[model samples]
Target: VSEELLFRGVLLGWFDRLLVERPSSTSLLFLPDDGRYARRGIQGEGWRRWGAIVASSLVFAGLHVGNGPEGHWFGPDLLPLFLLAIALGWSTRQTGRLTPAIGIHMLLNGLTVTLILLGASSS
Candidate 1:
């Protein structure tokens, strides 16, 4: 809940407003002249939206770098974390709300914790 609210709700939301809400050709070269990128919530079409998503996800993943074992900043973990962030951001973009993203985040966390616990118990 907190993570989604912070990352998807706040950070991603800010990006959408900055990139999508007030899109300008000068800022986004790929923007079409037809004003088709002016979507109400998510912002510009295709690449533009994807650009924001990727940027936000990267930031999210980068923040997690020092969160791994013994705070060693594992590089390999960043890839999977970035991928998860992308999915969460995409869900938030699709629904124009953070609820779905929160749900997905919780589900993933719960599943991972459960698997870890089960593995520990078995061993």
Candidate 2:
């Protein structure tokens, strides 16, 4: 919950604000909370949107060091974690809410915990 609020909510929101040209009146992304921009296919703000997502996702992956199979800053798991962050960022942007991203995070965390409990190391 807290991670979602901080990373997906605050951190990504901050990046979006910086990259996007004046976000919507009520929300962080260009469109309103209604997620209108998604159907339009990220046309005008493609670079801005990807810029924010990639930047935030990089931070997300970097901070996950020692958090799982991605136990080091320089490790094989970093790429996958970065990719997952990208997916999470996309979900957040497409929905104009953190629910989908948070749910995916929860599912991944749960799976990680289960794997740990099962002593299934090495990704």
Candidate 3:
């Protein structure tokens, strides 16, 4: 709940509002100049929105380092976490709401815990 509120509800939400709500004269790769991007809503704004997603996802992944096993930064774990963050952020952006992101986060965490418990019990 807290993590979703912070990352998806706050950070990603802010980014979408700031970078996606407005249009610039900048022409980015894969973005059309006929205002078609804006017409498609979140698909518009090109790289700026993508930049926000990447930035926020990085921060989300970095924040997990201290909470991992041994409380140390694990380089190997960061990539997956970053990817998960990107997915969550993308969901939030697409829905224009945090519910889906929060739901996905909860589901993933639940599955992780279930796997851990299953592994422990089997052992």
Candidate 4:
């Protein structure tokens, strides 16, 4: 999906690069798409909309988990991935444009990778 590619791909890839190049200090956040969406205009539209995002996020996280042992289950890993997914999905809906969310996503990922390389910490 374009959404995944732009947000996750850009952020994750950039962070990975930072880890390899810097490996000194950085940080990252795992925001859910719903959070982003909520930031825009997510109200109490009944349980349907709320349920939709939740289900979608779970599926997104599950796919990541299914990737391989590299994407194996880990409390730290799952939490962030799920949260980020929620943010990405929600953002796309909120702004009616995936670019902003992807940009923010990439920024977080970049910081994360940089931190990893810097030996700061993993989130």
Local distance difference test values of all predictions, in order: 0.80, 0.82, 0.81, 0.57
Q: What are the TM-scores, per candidate, against the unseen true structure?
A: 0.73, 0.74, 0.72, 0.50
lDDT of 3 by residue, 6-91 (tens): 98878876776787675454644546677676566665567778878988898899988666555768777789899999999888
Per-residue accuracy of model 1 over 3-30 as CA lDDT, tens digit each = 8888888888777666655655586687
Ranking by lDDT: 2, 3, 1, 4
- lDDT (tens digit, per residue) of candidate 4 on 1-123: 465664444543343344323222231134434454443333434344445555666766766663433556654567777898878767765666657666876787688778767774543
Better of 2 and 4 by lDDT: 2
Residue 68, model 3: Cα distance from true site in angstroms? 3.6
Whole-structure CA lDDT of model 3: 0.81
Looking at candidate 4, the ten consecutive residues that score lowest on lDDT are: 19-28
Candidate 1's displacement at residue 40, Å, is 16
Residue-level lDDT tens digits of model 2 in 1-123: 788788789988899888876445565543456655554446757888889999999998888856755456578778988999999999998899999998999999998898887885554
Question: In model 1, how many backbone clashes occur?
Answer: 0
The collision pairs in model 1 are none
